[model samples]
Target: MVIDMQKYFLNPVSHAYVESGPAITQKIKALQDCCLGRNIPVVQTRHINTKEGAKRMDRWWGDLITADNPLSQISNDLKCDKATIITKEQYDAFLDTGLEQLLKKQGISQLIITGVLTHLCCESTARSAFMRGFEVFFAVDGTASYNEQFHLAALLNLSHGFAVPVLTSEIIEQLESRT
Candidate 1:
């Protein structure tokens, strides 16, 4: 699952821009391509705020990504046409987003997570997925944050308790070996 790879977090001009966004975007694209080639379903998440859902988020961040915002759109670099797009209002993708049900419907028991804001959306989703009984593989190199410290801190915390932290190349090699 790719979490919040929209321009809101990726584009440098954005207030929420992640410094590692460009590098991670390329890595995520590679991982997505590999998944597509192997017929493994790729789930992409877009974080958007609705008036009702933005209450808490707005209170905390004082900003929101509304549906009409161009930055709210998923990055064009990703092959979204071949992936399932999941729109979410919170940091946790499974929160109010039928993401768990969608994975179950597709017989997907595991999720490889990638995208921006490693310390926020990605980490939250990883923890949520783990609690929901889904095995989570967090893409260390395919996720980014506002700074390296935040990114590494998230990876460390997640690896200790919630997820298996892995690089994009390692994931791709493992998938290739399986086939």
Candidate 2:
């Protein structure tokens, strides 16, 4: 699953939100293309904030990522037309979303997680997936954040308990090698 790879997170203007966003966007697109070519199911998630819910998040992080904003739209580089797009209101993609049901419908028990804000949405969803009994292959370089330390922290924490940290290339190779 690609979590929060929208312009709001990936654009250079939002560097304060995620410094490595643009580069990570490219890495994620490459991974997405690899998955598409291999016929692997790819789920892309976008964070859409509601005005009412915005207040809560704003209190902590200030107003950002409003719904209907172009920033909230997924990056054009990542073609979600061939992927299942999931809209989320909070950090965890499965919260009140059809993610779990969709996964079940497709008999998908494992997920390769990639996207922006490694410590926030991506980590949240990874933990949630693990708690829900899904095997998580978290891409270390596939996820971006404000800095290398923050990104590594999330990878460390996830590798410790919630997920198995992997590289984008490794995942692409695995998918390509699969029948």
Candidate 3:
């Protein structure tokens, strides 16, 4: 699952931009390509705020990614034509989104998470997925945040209990070995 890899957080001009966005974009793209080649489903999440769902986020951040914003769109660097796009309203992608149901329907018991805001959406989703009984593999190199402190802090916290922190190359190697 790729969480919120939109231009809102990736483009340098954006207020929420992560410095490592470009590097992680390539890492995520490689992971996605490997998954696609192996017939492993790739689920991409777009965080958007609806009037009804924006209350908490609006209050906390004072900003929201509405549907009409061009930055809300997924990054151009990633190929998502074959991915299952999940439009989410909260940091946790599973909330109010049909993500859990969709994964179950596809017989997917594990999720490899990658994307921007490692300390926010990505970490939140990883915790949520673990609580929901899904094994989560968090892509350490394929996720980014506004700064290294936030990024490393999230990885440390998540690795303690919520997720298995891994490199993109490790994931790709495992996938390649499977076939």
Highest lDDT scorer: 3
lDDT-best of 2 and 3? 3
Give the Cα lDDT of each candidate.
Answer: 0.91, 0.85, 0.92
lDDT of 3 by residue, 1-179 (tens): 88898999888888888788888888899999999999999999999998788868888887889999999999998847899999999889999998999999999999999997899999999999999999999999999988899999999999999999999999999999999
Can you rank all candidates by lDDT, best first? 3, 1, 2
RMSD of 1: 0.9
What is candidate 2's local distance difference test score?
0.85
**TM-score of candidate 3 relative to the true fold:** 0.97
TM-score of each: 0.97, 0.93, 0.97
Cα lDDT of model 1 overall?
Answer: 0.91
Off-target runs (Cα >4 Å) in candidate 3 are none
